[model samples]
Target: MLRTRRVGRGLSMAVCAVLTFSFFTACSRNKTGSSDSITVGVVLPITGREGKPGQYQREGIELAIKQINQNGGILVKDLDKKLPIKEVFYDDTSDQAKSAAFAERAMSSDNVVAVVGAYSTALGEAESVMPDRYQVPWITTGAAASTIFNHGYQYAFGTLSPTNLLGSTTAEYLGTLVDQRKLTKGLKLALALENTDHGVDYGNGIKEWIQQHPGYFVVVFSENFDLGSPDFSGLLQKVKSANADIFLADAHLQDYITMHRQYLQSGMRHLMISYGARGPESDARKALGDGVDYIFAGIWWSRNLPYPQVKKFNEDYKAFTGHEPDSWYPATAYDAMRALAKAIENAGTLNKTAIRDALRKVQLNDSLLPGQTLKFGANGQINTPFVIVQNKPGGKVDIVFPKDAATGDSIAPTPKH
Candidate 1:
């Protein structure tokens, strides 16, 4: 999966990130905290549409705990003892109210000082408010919508990048194709996005990029579709009739799968295709087979990154899960657990306010993100970049953006049916 191609503004940053990403730890002696195991709560969609990614996140958190406990656990300054993490979580089952309710219960009855869970913007936003309400520090592992952090919440932090960037990055990459003469300028584009803050941000980002770089692309069709819509035939038919040269869609996992099936069946061919954060998923590739080939996506994690840490983690992750990783879902959750441990160690006490303060100022170098460093900004969101991945022929997934870190070149004007 490691092929090199440099595109967009992604390569050099990834190059620099590779240089900086390292397994970093803090050496501090502490006491007055829990002498036994520390409790951290998790709330993730385990049985719903978001369940697959949630399961990956859960594995990531659990694996991190196993690794940390094996070493000596986190040292508490006041207690003068190292403590292992004890995770208490409920399957949110992808329900909004349940996510918040489970988060509340975990903090109240489960005795969790902090939480490192929740996936997708909808559920993450639902659980986010409870953290501040309970004075608990919640770090989102999967949510990326900037709106979650825009409300001036102090106790919520996230490891995912912003959605606006997801769209902007995808468009910029397409511009590179035009620059390379692989794609023609003034191409008609169709925009299909989910009806949520995540989708709106993506649409705005793409529009902003197109505005800044005139003559590269023109929006011919745009529509908002609900998540989990069973029939995309009507929408696909519209897209087919639009005579668009490229298609950009923002959807979740299930939507991506459902819509792509309809897209392939509709026989609508585009020079390029993107599914926001939805393409390059393992299940999509398996379900659609070669139909997904050459499809590009703005993704959080790709094993194709030219980093030894990613490679090592991939191997360890497979060993822990007994299955290959579908995407980068686990890394953020793994980093979230590490971040929490670091904050707890630095805080020197189990005090929630102190830990929240610690979280705001915390920085971890050995992160699974493209930027190689995990630090939250004023919005409690990690300002990270993303990689554009292409599902190549022969079941291959490669990073084609940030040419410096790209594992392969993108194939445009995908073969027509």
Candidate 2:
């Protein structure tokens, strides 16, 4: 009887311990659930030609994330919970193949709710296929090609103005300068562009605009060059020989630095040299050192604008990044994050379809760009305004065109280098 009672007591103790362990395990799993964090995947050219801009964009996104988290995270009405954002990043290396692969991985392996990436048009084109296939909403912060929007995919969206709009807006600004300020009349135009979609689209837009206004411009030279050409001396000589009053070049940041340096060194003098979409980069200033003066660029935003929203964003961004925000990339990425948060809140769940549907219906008003309201069209493209900024003496970039929004007067015939 004694032996049997002892055995029974041992069995009872073992059963109690197992039950306690099981109960605690179940409780822990429930407490630390997948709903605790929201994952957002970011893909960018952390290497190659776009490396610098990509780094800038990443920093901006991180700053937005930090600010959002500090504000008590994103609220989920369905779950009645707050979810912190988790960023899963991949380097596309600015390669098309790598971009496609990264997109696949971001969608499948990371299982991210949405993706932000592909700074270049080439990379954007390559990665676009996967998002539609996977039904993931892909927000592009830098790629501005119209083809990205024409693909008829509801899942893809770009925060930047399309190249067509950028090109025409730039030309229109130049026309205003010529007509109102009498900077130059019957201007002779020259075009030099990189051999990429970015170049082609801008070139087409310019051609269309010139065709629309025949007597306003005379095309002296139209040419395209390979990106990252080590020396732009040959190109600069061609541009000089053209002797066009206004020279327009569509190039990336590195190319902008290289070509402009070569232009200044080669003593090319035009009444106006407008660099499309490449002037907001600090690299240009670093490389040229006063060479960038008098050059105008079509941009999406500028810090010098006098507005409460602009001031607040500039101060907050400077506090976070230790530098002022550039034209488009960072602001676009920041807007993307805020838009994503709104979609998540509206959807009330982490379901991709619901989030996408909600995103399509949402209208973003707190954008950094003035007079611009962001709403996704059925085709997943954002319609926004473009601004013109001229680099003034002493490293000041002031908004000179769009008269109603002008921050300073136009400085034309930039002092000869």
Q: Which candidate's TM-score is highest?
A: 1
| Candidate 2 residue pairs in backbone clash | none
Write down the lDDT that model 1 would get.
Answer: 0.87
Q: Per model, how many backbone clashes are there?
A: 16, 0
* Model 1: worst 10 consecutive residues (lDDT sum): 23-32
For model 2, residues 166-268, the per-residue Cα lDDT tens digits are 8888888777766776566678889999888888889888878878877677788989998889898888888888878889999888888888888887777
lDDT tens string, model 1, 1-417? 234444434688887676655321111112223348888898998898899999999999998889989989988888888888887878999999999999998876666889889899999989888888889999999998878988999899998888898888999999999999999999999999898889999999999999999999999999999998899999888988899999999999999999999998877889999889877787987788888888889888887777777888889999999987677899889989999899999998878899999999999987877978889898899888989888888888889997987988888878774
Question: Cα lDDT for residue 10, model 2?
Answer: 99
What TM-score, over all chains together, does every model reach?
0.90, 0.89
| Model 1 stretches with alpha carbons more than 4 Å out | 1-34
What is residue 32's positional error in candidate 2, in angstroms?
A: 13
What is the TM-score of candidate 1?
0.90
Judged by lDDT against the true structure, how good is candidate 2?
A: 0.81
